[model samples]
Target: MVPEANPRVGQLTTQWQRGKDKIAAALISLVLIVGVVAQAGFAWQVHLNGEEIGVVKDKASLVALIEARTHEVEADKGYEVGLASQVEFRKIVSFSSDDAEAVKETLSEGLEFGLKATAIIVNGTEVAALATLEEAEGLLEQLKSRFIKTSSNLEVEAVRFREDVELEETYCRVEDIVDKDAALNVLLHGSEKLLQHTVARGESLWTIAFKYQLGVSSLKAANPNIKPEVLPIGSKLSLKLDEPFVRVEVVEKQTYNKSIPFATTYTTDSSLWTWDSKVKVAGKAGAQQVTARIVSVNGKEEKRDILSTQITASPTTQVVARGTKTAPSLSTGTFLWPTTGVITSPYGMRWGAMHSGVDIGAPKGTAIKAADSGMVTFSGWNGGYGYMVKIDHGNGTSTLYAHSSKLLVSQSSVVEKGQVIALVGSTGNSYGAHLHFEVHLNGKQVNPLNYFR
Candidate 1:
């Protein structure tokens, strides 16, 4: 009778057991999923060098806070600033949220802050710092550009700093950072010290200013009481020195035109004597354009590289015809003007004495040529004629050059017409720089204007 239990009860008990087993499995699965999620980090905590600093919702939130802090520091410092500490992040499972504003406030007040800037360093020493890399580069460019010369004849190709310059991105204190103007001043003048100069005897304003590379007007402007005509001895004068500290190198492409000297060619003919010659073709100078790469430091040229040379015009060689005929005539009997100048003083005798010569006005170093082909009979210093040259032609005429700076021919050298024999000078018995030319006919002094072609 006990084994015959109710069939409905047995069925109900088995169903309840199955329901309980299903609920337990679901609970276990939920616990496992919770455990897995807990293993994965849900939040990030900030650390400084291994010490826990703070926590944030996410990396993006942390970054936003940092940026905001940086801007805040900029507003307060009147310049741009970086975080002072080495920061790192670690993941942790936590549900608590961090106050972003509180973290930023802590950064501004409690933590030491620095500006993230580019520093111009030389030889591992920090020279200056700027807000951005562009500023840094522009500062250096300005430094180099100061040494560049801009002109139609010069094209600046490149500019650079000669020093071993380095731009390092570093986080430095606000006090350590320098403005562009301040940095430039440091590189150019190096100090705020004033310069002064004491005047000595025989030192004029122009000479004193020139010695210090300053303009006379600037010197005068600096000291008002100082007079230009009379500089007092032992006077204290203010001088502003323009001295540079950095070495800036500049590359320039310079274009210049040069003249090519024409060569002379001679040909002999049987009809004329060996001393007789005629110009067949006139000589012409050529022109060439040269392009050179000039390297300079601090406005002083250091090196030059010839890049290209273009011949703009070809030179025409001068051709002259000579004769081999041996005749009794050695002179053409005609003459060319000694030099290209105006006849300043005519041959006369009205100056209480015999002037005896004509004066040709020319530059001091102008070339004086032979009037006619002849043999030089006298060349040296004469009493009133400071360097003198006398040429005797086979005809009855002789030419003389007086008051010359130099004589090219000796006593026996044969000269041709238009040959440079001396330089124009005011050597003896002269009022100014001029060529004292004279002509002698049968040993008698005559007017020199009567014998030129």
Candidate 2:
């Protein structure tokens, strides 16, 4: 200060002070930047319908991962799928970055997919969902064909479902889509589960089989120890019924040759007993070609119509002479009609099996009359005949009345022609209310229709 202030000294001092301040300001800025980097970071938080799933550092990377997951699902399921949940990316400042795999896995767990599928609708109720329409249609076709019985004499006119079956386009959950086979099984079975049946009053093997659309043979096979001739009340029977959910109506035209039955007439002969008769002319069956239109449901015949009948030959009528002098209480050489009804089943080769008796369809409890006067040989429950009555007429002749609801006479009791002996019923292995009538000549079964007048 003494002599004059040195200008260089002053300038150096000023420069030092300015440099110190600059360094301090730089340090402050650096501290501020470090604080910002530590406290906050740019990241993407995944939100599904306002529910946070996960976080990722790079939005584009997360998006790529989600896309990959979608493709993976689509490839595995063999169907196109889309995200069903609401997805949103929120800008967030996270302390640390999240791994791509973790973010994707979390999002995948939270998100749901919508599948494009076809639902099989039966009567407005959805039964099964298939991946494609073609698969649905194929399944329906398979159901229709399941009941078709192919035969050379049949011409399939039409095949359809009884219900309003349709394939509807729909969007379902990813889990709703099923394999073709599974869907088919659902349509085929569909909650119609009837695994067993309990016998009730007036129920027979034929009735049970008809109710479940099962064959009598099949029903017997399912319950090996069951007796079709006697269905005891409250007894359980195993059922093997697998009818489709919707009924399949198969309309077909069948053409085949049928045998025309011969008629038997009588002539008056006062010399013999009323129950005795001698065949003057043997019966010979005529031939006819028949064309019929049949409608079937679930392989069971529902309706049949005879389209045309070409008589190949005229039937030969049998003649028999009976005595008028025989007492009414004893078996005269003549016979009378047992019950008034249509002959349902005839005695002959039926369904490639021998049918030993004629079936007469009548209402239950209808009076069953004796064909001729004879002594009661049997009057009790038979294995297949159910409630039965048998009468023995002299001269190597006997008659049986089967499937009766009640027996009015006992064994060893004598009955005359036109006497009420039993009541009609559908017991045992029978189908409906009917009488199974049989006649034997010389220890051999004969056609009862041929002997009835």
Candidate 3:
């Protein structure tokens, strides 16, 4: 109608319109691609208090990462986050009453927090962040100064990292000293094997062995030359279980000087020398070989060896015979029998036993006298000897009286010759009333017959 609008023109217009629509669609697609590229190229830097810590690529990823980090922090700090933004974050830090009580006391007056702060920059916008609950708690103080209120009872002290720790030093101590070989040697061979006995009246070697839990053979082994059946009472005897040997070697020598004065003089006048003076003498000595013999307890010689000997000092022999030779007075005292009794046993072997001490068979209650002047060293009932008395004469000699029904003297009492010391009886291992008498010299029992007459 409007000048018969050309159909071709109309068709061209429609074509142009379709072309325009296509271009618009292409432009829209290009815009979408640009948006996607921009988003893909978006990057973020994460920092703790301006110190770079990590990076993120896109807005969505950044948000997700921050949320995840916040969750991690919350998990660690046992708290929850409320708001997170580019400028600040708000969180609730919860502490157990038991844990918070101490913190409450320490921070009741307000505490300064040492923050572990993180700054996240996205699209040129800086977002301060705290990743862990501990960081959030630390940031709480800063936020409080900035008028950010938080209901937190968390008081975190500044962390001081250390690579090494100090420890106490220890020292070793010595406890004992050791000499193995010497100790072992002593343990193996240092003990003496011997038996000891104090002689009792009527005790022969046989009776001694019997009383001391040994055999006659053992007693004989200890005492080589002794006849057991005639053992003298009051004698000390040794019974050897084994022979003992010792080795001695001289290790050193020393000398000493000695001056000896031999005589003394008495002067009545102090003038012009009637001279009372003593002569001094010097002595010289040398060394000699010394030998030791190991013997059995029964007096049997087992082994002998020479040890070293050195002169310690010089020796001088000064023999001074001062008394004139005169005949000694003959002893004239009558020897009374110590006990009044019949001689039931003589001083000889009887039946199978050797009679050691003479036995004077007496009725019970017969008085017994000391044979000589001596000190009573023993007054007691000895095994198989009844009651006994031992008198010690000076010079290692002694006498024994046994088989007493009663004792009149105590031990260590002095008695004169012919003093009554006991009443004869059968009080110990005796078959009848009798007095047993024995004699000893230098600790060795000798036959009474040798000295009686």
Q: Pick the candidate with the highest TM-score.
A: 2
Mark the regions of model 2 whose C-alpha exceeds 4 Å error after superposition.
1-40, 58-65, 97-104, 192-245, 265-282, 318-453
Models sorted by lDDT, best on top: 2, 1, 3
* Predicted structure 3, TM vs. truth: 0.27
| Rank order (by TM-score, best first) | 2, 1, 3
Candidate 1 vs candidate 3, lDDT winner: 1
Task: For candidate 3, write residues 1-453 as lDDT tens digits.
Answer: 459767799899999999999999999999998777565634444333334333433224434545665666557554454322231112222221123233223222221122233322222432223333344334333322332112332222222211111111211111111133332232223344676787888667767777777788877877787666666777778865432122222121222233333333332323221112222333234334333322222122334443434444445543322322221222123335687767677766789887777778888898898877777778988888879998766656677898788999997567887899999888887888888888777666666766657
For all predicted structures, in order, the TM-scores are 0.39, 0.49, 0.27
Q: Report the C-alpha lDDT of model 2 over 333-446, residue by residue, as the tens digit.
A: 777778989889999999999999999999999999999998787899998899999887777788899999999999767898889999999887899899999998877999
Top candidate on lDDT is 2
Q: Which stretches of candidate 3 lie over 4 Å from their true place?
A: 1-335
**For each candidate, how many residue pairs have backbone atoms clashing (under 3 Å)?**
5, 11, 8
Residues forming the 10-long window of minimal summed lDDT in candidate 3: 169-178
- Per-model root-mean-square deviation over C-alphas: 18.4, 16.8, 29.3
